[model samples]
Target: MPQTLKTLGPKAAADLDGDLMSDAGGFSIDQLMELAGLSVSQAVYNVHPPSAGNNGGDGLVAARHLYFYGYTPVVYYPKPTKKPIYDGLVKQLNNLHIRFDNETPFDKLAGESDLIVDALFGFSFQPPVREPFDQAIAVMEKGVKPVLAVDTPSSWHVEDGPQNEGLGSKYMPDYLISLTAAKPNVGHFKGKKHFIGGRFLGEDVAKKYNLNIPEYKGLDQIVEVPVDVKVEKL
Candidate 1:
């Protein structure tokens, strides 16, 4: 049988996420987020343990780990969340001198970089996008640069894919790093590659929610889920 992974809608995803971060879950939010970021970095490097390593912004975490993996990443964090987690992630990037071109135009960014990791809007983003981010998504839709989204593409709904049957619906990343488990919207993910990563989901969590996630081989933090496999509700 082909390898299978369960797909969760946003509500289920949110609930499961809460459980993973709860005292009963025995996971610190930062710790789990670190694993998530590491998993994403590993996926980007396309290697397992003993090979390459391990986000806050999710993008921030990915950027830091990618730097450790020997990739020169230039970031575009126009508006940053003021949370301590984000600050800490930024500090790590600053120590490494990872470029954060908040002033550079999106089209220019598209041309200058090899890959655009779209962490502009994470899983919680609602459609009819606000300020600069709206412009960012627009540029990605039209640009030629390859994109690797951290979770859902900027304006896409967690369960329904794109909010508008407009540009967002048309835009797809070159790669998508599905955190923890694949979200239902991934069925609409028209990216060139899809990867599932994250190491904090316990057997209890999965069993309670009936999440049929993949088993990470050995010490690997990520697993390549062949995009051809059909996605179904859990």
Candidate 2:
């Protein structure tokens, strides 16, 4: 039998700001990010190990650096910009020995990659995605391989799914790895697999926010969250 899954509404999910302070585990946002990245990489390895190549955005790029650990080679397609954030990410990728193609067309990269990690945007991103990201999403939608989204699918509203109409249904991902707690958009996730990572919240913090997150068994850092499960208030 499938395990019972718990769901949280946007109102309750938004209160998960517990990471702002050190919890019982004494994990800070930086530490949580490191663990989250490792968990995401493990999820990818368990489900779909990189074959032809792994393609992704900033979040996936960060995770891939941790995932491959300066060993495996992956591809990244960044928007044409000199933003300091992108510069920092590039520097990290260089240190990790990850390869990226900022000039090649999006469609070409999609065709070559075996898996696509939708890290272009997170739950915070609002629709009518701008510029190169819009184009990048289009190419990802056209590809045949499965896509694993970080947080929420790019181009998707945190409270609403791809109801934007402009992006269309093709923008949905096959798998999702939500950070911290599942966001409101997760309620509409139609993917085959949904996993939650970044589980560093203390019991007191979780209760204060009414996060009601399930416990991670044993030493696992990530837990599967089944879709279409019963909804419960936090």
Candidate 3:
């Protein structure tokens, strides 16, 4: 239950019910965001491990352009309730020394980016994205640089399984980092085979990655790729 609901008594909760407790099944949006962010982080570490002396056997970590497209901006959110959420995430990205942009111009973003991280639409998204997200899609489409989508690529339908639609906004990331669990949508994803991984970091890896939260730490590590996971593809 949401913190707001938990505070209310049964009758009070019932009075304001429906939307407050809409039947979206189990997971909350906040949990999903955390899952998505941490999953991407793990994937980044796997694909681009730090140098031997740095973290894991990770090589020298390079700063790359990471794009965060969803409703929330990395460093800030217009809504007061959402500020801390985005801020915490932005701090993490900054701690990792990543360069990121949110809803910037397509041409300018394309020219500047080496790697793009798609943190936009997820399993919760229904259909065509509205104004800002659509605009974000346009910019992403302007370039063919490598991408690592946070959950599923924007506009990719989770309900339909992971099949490539090949539409203008039907993005297929080079890597589709699933959050807590793998979703069927990825198999149908269009890019090179999606590499399935999660934030289920082992305790030692968590310590290595500087993740200390009790609930957030100790997730099962999924990949065995070298610490320095980046490479030039053929």
Best by lDDT: 1
Worst 10-residue lDDT window, candidate 3? 53-62
User: Stretches of candidate 3 above 4 Å error?
Assistant: 1-36, 48-83, 90-103, 161-170, 199-220, 224-234
* Runs off by more than 4 Å, candidate 2: 1-15, 22-27, 50-89
- TM-scores for all candidates? 0.89, 0.80, 0.51
Question: What's the alpha carbon RMSD for model 2?
Answer: 3.5
Worst 10 residues of 1 by lDDT: 49-58
Count steric clashes of candidate 1: 3
Kindly list the per-residue Cα lDDT of model 3 for residues 167-230, writing each as its tens digit: 4344546655544333445445555433434343345433332322223335633332221223
TM-score for predicted model 1 compared with the true structure: 0.89
Clash list (residue pairs), candidate 1: 37-55, 38-54, 55-61
TM-score of 2: 0.80
| Location of the lowest summed lDDT over 10 successive residues in candidate 2 | 1-10
lDDT to native, each model: 0.75, 0.65, 0.42
What's model 3's overall lDDT? Answer: 0.42
**Can you rank all candidates by lDDT, best first?**
1, 2, 3
Clashes of 2: 0
Relative to the true structure, candidate 3 reaches a TM of 0.51
